[model samples]
Target: MPGTVKKDVVVGLDIGTSGIAVAVLNRSSVAIQEPLGFGFCSSMIMEKGFIGDSEAAAYNVKKALDEALTAAGVPFTTAYVNVDGPELVIRHGSVKQAITRRQVVDARDLIKLQQHLCETVLPEDVLSIIQLDNIRFYIDGEYVFKPQGCRGRELGLSSTVLAAPRRQMDLIWQCLRNAGLPPTTETVVGALAVAQGVLSGVERKLGVICVDLGAGMTKVVFINHNMLYKLSIFPAGAGNITADLAVGLHTTLEAAEKVKKEYGLGLIAGDVHVPNISGSGYNTVPGSLVHKIIKSRIEEILDFVKEFIEELDLGASLPGGIVLTGGGALLNGLTEVAQEYWLMPVRIGFNSLPGEEAPNEDAYRYTTAIGLASWGTGQVYPGMRQKAEKGFKGRIKSWFR
Candidate 1:
């Protein structure tokens, strides 16, 4: 048998619904420079996290991977892909078991506890389980972070468990396979990667809600006391607003998208003139009407957020405020809208890495991809650690692995 050689490169591919974003990082350096390569493609044929046209999706993924590889000047294959959507499920639970009076608990026992919880609570189709914390354990009725070498007749364990459906994950795996690269790891959407890039220690400890508004989906995670409590996804996104404009104005999607980028506002309070696009005379639509359409969709999306937060009873629990990121977060008036709907202090999320200059003020669209690369190189904000899940957390950790 021949010994396998180690590869010097790590790549992070965010397979989004509206497009594909590929980021390549050099592993030998402590800081990440400009991405070795970056590529994007329109996600025209994907629906609800499934690829409708394998050929189109495969082509996009391949082009992105090839370009990233070329820019990084690395030829070795394999990548850590970020999974976008799977209707993530999260729960907090505790387990209790007896320990020998004189024996010490260890990491292996924690792993055993995790496995036991998985077997007891997770469904058969679960693609991953991330143990967020060992949390505090009750040993002989005394709570402690570490129970090793402690005498106790009873041990209680509490942790966060995050799970995703297996079918939702197959799409990403299949895409990578078609792209001529085996997936080295598969991470959950809006998880450790985003936390690494956007969250601060104070924010995590004081309690914060991170919302990633992508093109086709908006994912949210709530952190309280440095622990993740809630994760949810909404179907409506910036793409939905664009589609609404396209249909309402009877314009081509491209033109509608252009109008959105150029003049779209989430809530227009007064009358505004519509531009003379396509060399036609200025066609006017009521600012209120436009606002109504955009607001309706955005409100629906935020309503989902509210419902999820209320469901988890986290609305009052999170005090660090809300941070919004991802491509769709660039939409005009989105932060204000989120504040009004989510009823929290909202701000745009940015990536801050050592040595690398902050991106252009207007380049919020690339936050995720930039964060993806920064995260891969271990330049994330301080205090973020990879949660524990082989499929999801493991894949996220591999950027540094």
Candidate 2:
């Protein structure tokens, strides 16, 4: 029972179209043992980031969560879940607040300024702000790192806001509730969570683009100057490549996926045997053709990233370059191809944060889940606050308004 557990636990749920992943961890700032439990279940209930069937989605979530809890010998009532979907809205805006009686700025003033920005910039009826970043506070017209002592009549704030449609979020909450997990204001952008799991402190501060190449979607998070600069999700991913192979090879999706994992290469090698659409026989196809099909789809996805980079005029500015993770990032020679296309260094990222011990090969699979757990340790979302769970302290303190 939730009341019986003596140790505080942190749970992270990474809901994706390809599967649902859960991580159970000790909620402590110091070094700890490995993850208490980890669980995953293949699911199609979610499609390209949106829940297509609430009933099916809930069932899958429960299946995964139960497995993790059973492994850990602990139970949890809430989890910090990742919100995946293409309908997320990200925008940049600025707001200003006037000081009362021209008094000196303090922590209370800073808090009020943030609250005012949240109220003025967000359309509460249509959109809910999920993450706020790139915030720069100012007194008058100049930037001030420590605004507590500055004396100014006006306070200003500029930030990037990531929001999702209220209707969609409501549906997500309902689905989780149906799974028996109470929904808290605590939530994270999937890509951002992935970055937290895989990126090093130096890498984040130097500037880098973290690309999560999941099965159904490719999510990108840009961190520069130790802050989130952008968050984007494209509707294309490894699943599309599998689909293309399925159609091109006249094979079932299952067979095509197997061929992809076995023979998919960035550059063609030689001919190989491929199973037909039916389970009956095999046929031979040029390795080049397989490469061609895979390359076309991969390029299409990378082109979206390239366009966004150019639009931001971020060319040649990011010293940390690109770090790719997610299931798709496991494809052979993908790093080389990405490096060639962007004319920059590209590397595969795995789960690097502490507290869990996973073989190198399996580390990439749980990158997002580990990151979500890391997000729960000390930092939290701005406005969403709930009373800490029994035996839990400072877990789920971050709230989304």
By lDDT, who's the top model here?
2
* Runs off by more than 4 Å, candidate 2: 1-6, 32-34, 96-115, 135-158, 183-185, 266-270, 352-361, 380-401
Candidate 1 per-residue lDDT over residues 1-401, each given as its tens digit:
47653345666666677777676665555443444555565566565556777767778988877765776676644355555554666667778777753556655455556555655566455454422432556776678755666666777776666655666555555665666765344443445567656888899898888888777888887777776666777776888988897667655567667767755555566654554446466566776777777777778888887787777766355667888887677778788778878777888887643223223643454456555555545422112223234433232222233
**Candidate 1, poorest ten consecutive residues by summed lDDT:** 379-388
Error of 1 at 76 (Å): 6.3
Residue 116, model 1: lDDT of 57
lDDT tens per residue, model 2, 113-171: 65556656664557665655666888888998767778988888887766777666666
Query: What do the candidate models score in CA lDDT, each in turn?
Result: 0.63, 0.75
RMSD of each: 6.5, 5.5
Clash tally for model 1: 0
Against the hidden reference, what TM-scores do the models get?
Answer: 0.74, 0.83
